[model samples]
Target: MMAFEFPGQYYEVIRGTLRDVHAETAYLADWLAKSGKATGGRVLDLGCGTGTTLRALAARGHGGVGVDASAAFIAWATEAGGDGLEYVRADLADLDVAEFATEEPFDLVVCLFATLNMVPPEALVPLLRQVRGRLAPGGHLVLDAAHLLGFVDTYQPSMIAHHQRDGVLLTRMVHTSVNGHTACWRNEETILARDPDGAVSMHENGFDQWVLTAPQIRGALAAAGFRVVAEHGGFRDAPPPPFGKGPLVQVAALDG
Candidate 1:
């Protein structure tokens, strides 16, 4: 796996600038509720960053385990403790479910915010299989990935964007490329923090992400012994969009 540069600072910047953490939390909670998967059961939030989803799940009366590879993220998440909520620091690609959910199976396992796109191609299916192994009977796995149509067909070249909030300035440059069936994204970011006394600090880091198509992703889930139960474009509960129309989400169940 490629090293993630400045993960802690990136999280902090985005949480304060580009993200409405509470809105996202509530939106996901509503999705689960509408899908009838909001039962107060054991839940695993794969690639959970800063425990945003887990906190919301716990509020819904569920037992939640939040796992991420970033120790900084886990540390921050741990500070937002709630009843029936826990955070684990580990790489999802090499996760050992037994080490965490030793006593029971998870009713719902979620990998959201295009998290699966970061998994190396060779390791994607194996990771899915591991997730499958930890699910309870009739349990559901929900994952989201960038849609090829949105990413490939509509590919845009390198561009720069900026965000500023609370005296912090974040500048991001994103480059997109497609090689055959794979899409590659490279992001370079620089952050500037200015203190009240005019002292300024700066940080910079970048990461690469590889993405696959909806069919490829669904095929991987099937290979991992999961059957697709429902799929949608973007976050809403609407019908799955046509290929290349929007970002995709898959809701699957362990195969018979």
Candidate 2:
């Protein structure tokens, strides 16, 4: 398990590399609105890296709390926090919701960007159940994972991706394999920095992720007392592709 501890410099390098913030935030805000979980409600962002989503939602007048395993990320988040927003440093799998739920029984719980995949198989269902117990009536749990189809059908030995900006260069390589229902991912990242004095430095880190199939994830939610209300291929509300292909996003509600 590779722990997440992205420093400020790392954040700066990738801040603009990802999707457009306004568009992405609006997309998520719209999803919550359509689900009847928006406005004046409370949101919980599990594995919330730097609390971007939480901050966005908070700015929209919804109270938000973000939790992540990395103290560095949480510190950055806290520094950027205000307006109906809070950041907590804790592992989602190990957190006691009662103690930190500034607003108890959240109206929405989010685990995005394949964050749910980080919870090991034995701990996944328990984590989901814990989330269920922390949701208000009619609350929704929205989560996504890298589809098994991609791992199974589009199998690749290794792939490299790189981004460079502001005198920083980041390169990543990922190697993937599957055994039975578990897909193993090994990822290595190298960061190169150049200072004003022409001094260059390099940093390297690696991590692993074990992913599950869409059906397996749905089943886990079901066993955790959730009813799958919707499923999609990605962030958009489009129909999911055939099994073993594309990402999987599931919106579930607590079962009575």
Measured by lDDT, the strongest candidate is 2
Candidate that scores best on TM-score = 2
Q: Rate the local accuracy (lDDT) of all candidates.
A: 0.72, 0.74
> What TM-score against the true fold does each predicted structure earn?
0.82, 0.85
Off by over 4 Å in 2: 12-16, 35-37, 101-103, 153-158, 165-168, 173-182, 194-200
Can you write out model 2's per-residue Cα lDDT over 1-256, one digit (the tens) per residue? 4455656556645655754557556666776676576687788899888877787788887887888888777888888766888888887668777777454678888998777876767788988988999888877888867665555675676767676777667665556544555556665555555644567766565555676777788899999999998887777768888644676778899888
lDDT (10s digit) by residue, model 1, range 29-114: 65556446666777889888777777777877877788888777788778868778888888777877778746677778888777
So what's the TM-score on candidate 2?
0.85
